[model samples]
Target: MSRIVIILACSLLLVACKSPEARRPISSKSGSFIDASVARNIKLNEKEQAYIKKIMSENPEEEYIASENGFYYFYNIKQADSLISPDFGDIVNFNYNIKTLNDDVIYTKEDIKTQNYVMDKQELFSGLREGLKLMKTGETVTFMFPSQKAFGYYGDENRIGLNVPLKCEVSINSIIDN
Candidate 1:
């Protein structure tokens, strides 16, 4: 049975290697291409799995509810302050930092020394859209997004592999238009 599993895993990796995108950017230094197929086979430690499952089960403490995408999205608002931003119909400017569940910095505007974009809510996941709706100009919020509402089971292996949990902190600097 183990042999069969190994064969199946190897086959999946081989398939990943044959893709056009696969030839461009491999995942890690180990030379393994981490695509949806690879993420499915990537072994998760018991602690990693447990932590992700735990985040999946958390609930918010305020009137603002998460996107119901099954991930816990929390915020840190100063007392007597509420988060408000552009409506779903408006565009907003935001800076952010993305990290692995283990707290490893995967991507960040500060680190990359750049800013992120959400074009009129046209190209973002559910959690990102919902999180922005809950923020105001000059407000900073941290969001914990599970794989489902995020990249889902199939992610961009060149950027972020599948089944990998992610955490992000977003700072809404200004609302250019609304």
Candidate 2:
């Protein structure tokens, strides 16, 4: 009986001394799906950029300045005065209209109405959010955005479709410092 109790104690001690093993995943992922998706997106971006270049060539009459932020623009109404542009927290009153590269109106200014955006604080789209930073009060600029800048994989979930590039005319009514 004493031998049996000693054997049970030895077995329990051995069990407790066993080291833990790392668990292997049921299924291992090779990341091939993510890699393929990234490659596809790159191709799509190149195609869209080429399309934008084509449009720019066709409209050589308008002097469009390529923005460092991956978009293009031309001032419809430039402000020559030394008025300050909006900073991080400034309030901007603006109106804009959206159109396709072919000049098809997607949303009229009335459709969008007036927008009061806090610079860099609001949930504005990437393209226009950066575009607005270049404007002063009473300046109207026309911006041409690539799909990546406008709406990438997911569109606006309304009129703007998937990966649709956009042309927009934005006019800043006022810029109030906050």
Candidate 3:
């Protein structure tokens, strides 16, 4: 009957409109798409790292220093004398401005209150933590972080996008030793 044909046609259309996840080709042996996704992520990460390095090289005036863990930084206001840098469990109060490698301002000191963190507490991004450890109170530094050291592949999911590198200028206001 005409009603039966109409129903079958609608059902066919519904199946054809299935979500992308349902339509994705599955691997015959593994039965999942994780391998392809991971490969794509790896490629993206490599591209991000190369881009950060190129940016650092282009800015000769900044005098960026590369660290073993892949973060790049240079002091804008170096600490004087033999001032002690923060150690584990020390609480630090600071102000910062964070931008993307493309120079898009993501956050600034004016956007929020003074940020504070306990040293080596994992309360901050890996690159920020590492840079802070090397700085003494009242010092300011500008740092560049590859995606892996900042937000990784997922990013902050808000101001930052996937695989995006970051730049931050931080001023250490005070350190409260525990």
Q: Which candidate is the best by TM-score?
A: 2
Model 3 agreement with the true structure over 53-123: per-residue lDDT tens digits: 89878887887787877787888998797488899999999898889888889987798569889998856
**How do the residues 53-112 of candidate 1 rate in per-residue lDDT, one tens digit apiece?**
565455334333345554555455432354455765565767787788767888876764
Rank by TM-score, descending? 2, 3, 1
Question: Which candidate comes out best when scored by lDDT?
Answer: 2
TM of each candidate vs. truth? 0.56, 0.95, 0.73
Instruction: Give the residue spans of candidate 3 off by over 4 A.
Output: 1-41
TM-score of 3: 0.73
Residue 137 error for model 2, in Å? 1.1
> How big is the RMSD of model 3?
11.6
Candidates in order have lDDT scores of 0.64, 0.93, 0.84
lDDT of 2 by residue, 27-77 (tens): 998999999999998998888788888998998988889899989999999
Please report how far candidate 2 places residue 138 from its true position, in Å: 1.3
Candidate 3 residue pairs that clash? none
Ranked candidates (lDDT, high to low)? 2, 3, 1
